[model samples]
Each structure stands twice: as C-alpha cells, then as structure tokens.
Target: MINPLAQFALLLDADLMAAALQQHLPECQAGDWQVTGCEIQHPRYKTYRLAENRDRSFLSLVYHLRGRHPAETTAEQRILYARAYLGQRSQQAYTEAQANGETAIHLAELGMVGWRFPDDPAMPWLAELMDSRQIAELEQRPISTIEIVNYRPEIRCTARYRFAASETEPARVVYGKTYADERGRAVYTNLLTLQRQSVAAFVMPEALAYDAGHHTLWLEGLQGHMLTELDFTVGVAEKIPALAHALAAFHQVTPPPLLVITSQQQLKEWLKKADKLSHAYPTIQPALTGLFNELRQDCPEFEVLGLIHGDFHIDQLLVLADGRLALFDYDELAIGDPLQDLANFAADLYNYPYPVAVIDQLVQTLFTAYSAANHNQTDAQRFVWHLRGQLLTRAYRCFIQQKSAAPQRVADFIALALRPWPLAD
Candidate 1:
C-alpha cells in the first residue's frame, strides 16, 4: 500500500520541492530559489524555508492540510507566506493579500500554534527590529548596517547591528533577538540576575534592553568562537575544566522566579513529546513507547532542586576573544535537578561525531571538574538516570531533524541509555 505521508515527503527533497513551489510561487519560476530548510509537524502541516539565490533573502512557506477544526473549516489546503525582509514589496504583498481575501494567518492557527513570524500581522514590531533608524536610536550610535544573523521562522530572529567608528565611539556590534511571544522578557530578567550574581570564570552577555511591547531583547554582541568549533585534541580540552567551574558557579546562584518542574511534570512532558514524534515517524513508535516506559519506571527522586539550564547544550556556549567563556540562551531557565544540566551538556558532547574514546574522556573530565568546583557534590545514580533521559531526548531530536542514519543513531543513543553508567572511575 502507498504511504499516505508520501505527499509531504516530497517537501524534503530540494529539487522536487523547488519545482512544486513554482506552482504557487511565481518567484520560483526564475529558477533561482531553493528550499534551504524545512520542518514537519506531521499529519497537519509542514513549513519550508526558501531563499532567493541572488539576494539570499529568506522567506517561510507553510502548508496546512489538516487541523483539529470541523471538516468544512479545514477541508481545503492553506498556504501561508512570511518573509524576513522589511521592504515595500513585502508590505504590498501583505496589504494586497488582505485585500484579495487570501487565507489569513488566523485561519491556520490550529496547525500553526506557537508560530509568530516576522510578517505576522500580529507582530508589527518585526519591522522595527530591522529598521536602521530605530536600531541607531536604541544603541545611541550611528548605525552603519543591519544584518540578520539567524532566523528560525515563527520562533525567533537574531539580528546584528553594526556601528562604524567615529571621532569618539569605537566600532561595535549589537545583537537583538525578537521573540514570538513574551518569553524574551523572562530571558532578559534571568540574564540580569545572573550578571548580578557575578558567577566566577564565566560571563553572561549584557542585556542591553528589553522592549516589552515588541517582545524584543537586545544584548551586547561579542566576538567569540563557539566551544563546539574548537579543537578538542589540541587545546580545547584544557578549557573543559574552566567550563565546568563556570557551570558550577552558575548552579550556585539562585534562579529568578520561575516554574519549578517536578518529576511528574517532566515525565509527562517527555511522553507527550515522544507521542508527537511518533506521528511524524511511525517506524519509531514501538521503540519510543518502550523507551519512555523504561524512563518513567527508572525515574530518579531528588530531595533538593536548584537552577538549571533546562536546555543546556554545547551550542549555547561561546569562547570570547578575551578568553572568557560566555553562556547564553536562558529561555529554558528553570528550577530542576542540577544533574539535568550536566547530563544535557554531556549528551550534546556526543553530537560532535567524535570517536567513542574521545567522547568518554571529555565527559569524564567534565564530570570530574564540575564535582571539584562544586565542593565534591556527587550522585552517580541520579546522574546516570538524568544521562539516560538526556540521551533519549537527543535521540528524539536526531530523528526529528531527519538527520542521516537517524535510526542507527537513535538505536545507538537508546542502547547507551540502557547500559550502566560508564566512567565511574
């Protein structure tokens, strides 16, 4: 029998996707457009990131075919467009689109929940984020140029504002992040708290400003290298101890007022995520079901909870030009088992595609350094439980992104999670 999901699979193929997009997007007729990235919410909707080959301007196209509404309300397919550009053409598109009675973004909310894009009618502040004059006023400097550093459509966009040196002020770059919701305010508050704590050995990026109305947060952009890109064999390994010490300092600080996630809530969240992924990749349903059950059964009980980077990973780490380590992205800041942060960082170490021996060494070194810096506080059983859970989460991510060798990678992670904690020495 033909797989019903095959229609959506075509979106994953760039060449075929370009051809299909041309049917709806006249710009694709120029043959200079390609699908740069994609996301699938399976059985309901799919989103594709398209870029113009010449200008490199990015746009988002979302297809909504199924929703939780009445059949008549969602029977027909809907195509929604969003662009990162703030130009006359984009404005005209939206205005004329409204005039033409095009499918409004609100109609697709059932499938596009939590998605707030730059071109969203509700996000008028997006234009200000990219506005050169507005940025200059915010920075109190003569802005030279504005460039988008990163944009995860409907989620967040990070833009860099450059200020050329004048007779007085020196050249500098400022970073800004526009959120889809009010979460940016929380992150801004968390950074302020962390900065006041003066965690030794590491620095939190200075929170420049927070626009409550626009849901945008600005920070002092730094010149640095991501820890992930550093050479592990050469000298990066030496920084591992410093990184651990910094993390210890971070854990010592009391997190700002935030939700304290309990063991029961964490279990429910993981199972829910697994259930969602199962719809996207039915092949892994059995494995996921069994693994989640094992995770719940083996869940650890903790007495004291503290501030943890709920989504701690290597990518959130940076090595500044001045040799200070910079940690960022406190959106997932929460009160939970501190081991979750350690396990999360350790799990991310495996994403480097390093040999088993190298990863083992790095993880062992990290754990040892963290223990020493934090007054020899250690819990092997609890740590192992968190590590297994983190590995399972990693497997879910690897599979969700449709990464190469996803099944084997998932199996490898699951297998590792089931094994007894190594590096006990």
Candidate 2:
C-alpha cells in the first residue's frame, strides 16, 4: 500500500514537500531550521517554527476548507482550543510514525494541486496558448522545455522556459508566473488588460500569453536593471523622472473597468486589525494608534477618484537597458485617491539605502514631476493627512514584518507620520 505522505507529494514537486516536512519533527536532521515542536491536528493544518524561537514566533498554515471559524469576539479562547486540538493530532501522528518508518505530511488531502510536472516537456495547454497568441518575440518557435524556478505553495509558481528554435530568439529567454488558484487567475487576467491599456504611455512587460484554465501568464522577460537593485543615491536623478511620468500618465486615464477598491469602511476594519497586532509593537503602537485615530476621525473627501497602483514600490519598477522605465506586478491595482500611490512610493523609499534627506529629496523629485505632468491641485492639507496615514500604516506593517528593524528606522517613520507631509506647502 502506498503511504499517504508519498501520494500527497506527487501533486507538488517531491523534493519541495520533503524539505518542508524535513524541517519539522526533528526526526529529519538533514537540514537546518529545525522545529522545537509541532502539533499536527490534521494532515492539512501543520504548524511549526525554528527550534530556537518557538515561543516568540511560529509558522502556521490553516487551509480555507478546514471549517475555519469566522472572526469571533472570543478569539483568545478559540486560538487556545485550536492549539489544544493540534496537540491531540500531533500525538496521533507520532504513534503512526512509530508504526511506519516515516509518514510525511499529506497535503493533497487538504485540496492542493501543485503544478510542478517534470515529466511532460511541455504542458499541452501552455503550448497552445503561446502558439495561439502568436507571440512575436518567440520568432515562430515553441516552448521546448521548462523548469520551476520558484514555487510558493498555494500562491504562485515562477517557471523558466527554453525555446525549441534558434537560441538567439528573444523568446528563448523567458519567465512565466502561474497562479495556484482561480482568484489568482482572475487577478493576472486583469493585469493583462491593464498592461494592454497602458501601452505607448507606460513601460510594462510585453504580454505573451494568458492561459486561463491553468492560470499561467507569460510575458517578455525585461531582464533589465530594476530600480530597486540600484543604489538610489546614484540612480534616482535619472530614473525618478521616468517613474513619475509613467505613473502620472497611468493615473491620467479613467480606472480600468471592474477594478475594485475598499474605501473608508475598509480602513476602519484594517485599523481594528492593527489593534490586534498591538502586542507585537508595544512601543510604536501608541504613535500608530494616534495616527489611526486621526485617520478615522477625519475621513477626507476624495478630491480626485483616480487610479492607483495599490501596492506600488521601488521594487515594482525596472530601468531597462534601452533607457526606459518599466512597471510590473499589477496584482494590487485599484481605483482610489491618486495621492495614495505617491504615499505608497514614498514609504517604500525607506527600504532603500541613503540618508533620510536623500530619500526625502528623491520623493520630492517624483512629486514635482507628478504635479508638473498631471497638474493635480489636491488640497495640501489633505495630502498631508493622506501621507501621515500612509506612513502610520506602513510603520505598523514594517514593524510587524521586520520585527528586528532598527529603533531609529521606526522613529524615522513615526516622525514622518507626525510631521507635516512633504510638498504640503
């Protein structure tokens, strides 16, 4: 009889699944990042973390199908109950492990279909999509072979494909991103539409193909120097203008159809979520809450209901060899106050190198370019408020994600939050 663990891994790549399982349950010492302990209440929901920092932090993946209870008032008790249940499950898994030599996790039991198929040189549908689209970059050649470069389980797969024809064809150098589920499929589809609309106005990846059934998207690999990769102090002078111009042009048009945005109500709900993470950031939480209160108290009117790249940042842009700036990753596209994009970009500037003054100058450069190109006359006070709120939320998230951020960096964000917004005067 085939072990359930082996069967589960067949859907995903075998090695990847083993690496995850091997990290936990000390039984597999082949790698570092050992887990101190883990409770497996079900084959589907496995929770574990590094051996040293088990209490301070841990990792957990709860599948959507696992009867996850709705957000309830008694979250503390519910979390306690779930942890206890996981202990019970772990006990059962240990007993089975002793019976058999080894029993890895059975992820497929939880409804996961990993898309790493090594046997088929090419998936039929993928080939058809490329062929039908008549991808000009391919030079009439077909995708000869492929390999999974990266896979984030239940999220996305980054695959690199080689062309069957002449090696010199630009298509030979290609990378594709495949979504794990239907929703990811729809988002990427929307991205293609937005990309097409921006042509002649913005530099985005050349669309090659969109495979809806499999949720795979192919594009011309720009393979250029990304703005994020450069030292901003050296590159910002030239690159910032191009980025600002592209964004201004994109915001100039009416928002793409069906682009959804969560407005004031969403902000309120997210602030409540921020409250939950308060424990993780005791020192910063006070300032954060104050800004949150300000945002909540003064819900400003949208002077311009314009387009925004909801998740814009330095990393989302590229400085191609041909002296053009390109943008990618449209997953967070939304229709909102255009200033939101500027605020998002400013916050991201902190992530790069250089002194606060240098960062501030770059931001000002972008803002100046934006204002000149688009002629936005939004109220200065409103821009200040919007930027403050953006800094607050960004600080909260930065503290949450990078817990070890320097005290000074957190302080910088707080100061930015409280100070009058840049370009306000």
Query: Which candidate gets the maximum lDDT versus the true structure?
Result: 1
Please, what is the whole-model Cα lDDT of each candidate in the order they appear? Answer: 0.66, 0.55
TM-score of each: 0.76, 0.66
Q: What lDDT, from 0 to 1, does candidate 2 have?
A: 0.55
Residue-wise C-alpha lDDT for candidate 1, range 1-425, written one tens digit per residue: 23322432454444554344444343334443333323333222222222232222223334322222222332322223333222233454445557754433321211111222335444556767777887778667799987766665557777888898989889988888888889898899888887887557467778998988778898998788988788876456888898889888888897789889776777787786677556556676777787788778777755558998888888888998888898888789899888889988888887776796798788888888988987887776667667877887877776555455666887777667666566442
Candidate 2 lDDT over residue span 195-232, tens digit each: 66744455877667766766777776776876777777
What does the lDDT read for residue 177 in candidate 1?
88
> Considering only N, C-alpha and C atoms within 3 Å, which residue pairs clash in candidate 2?
none
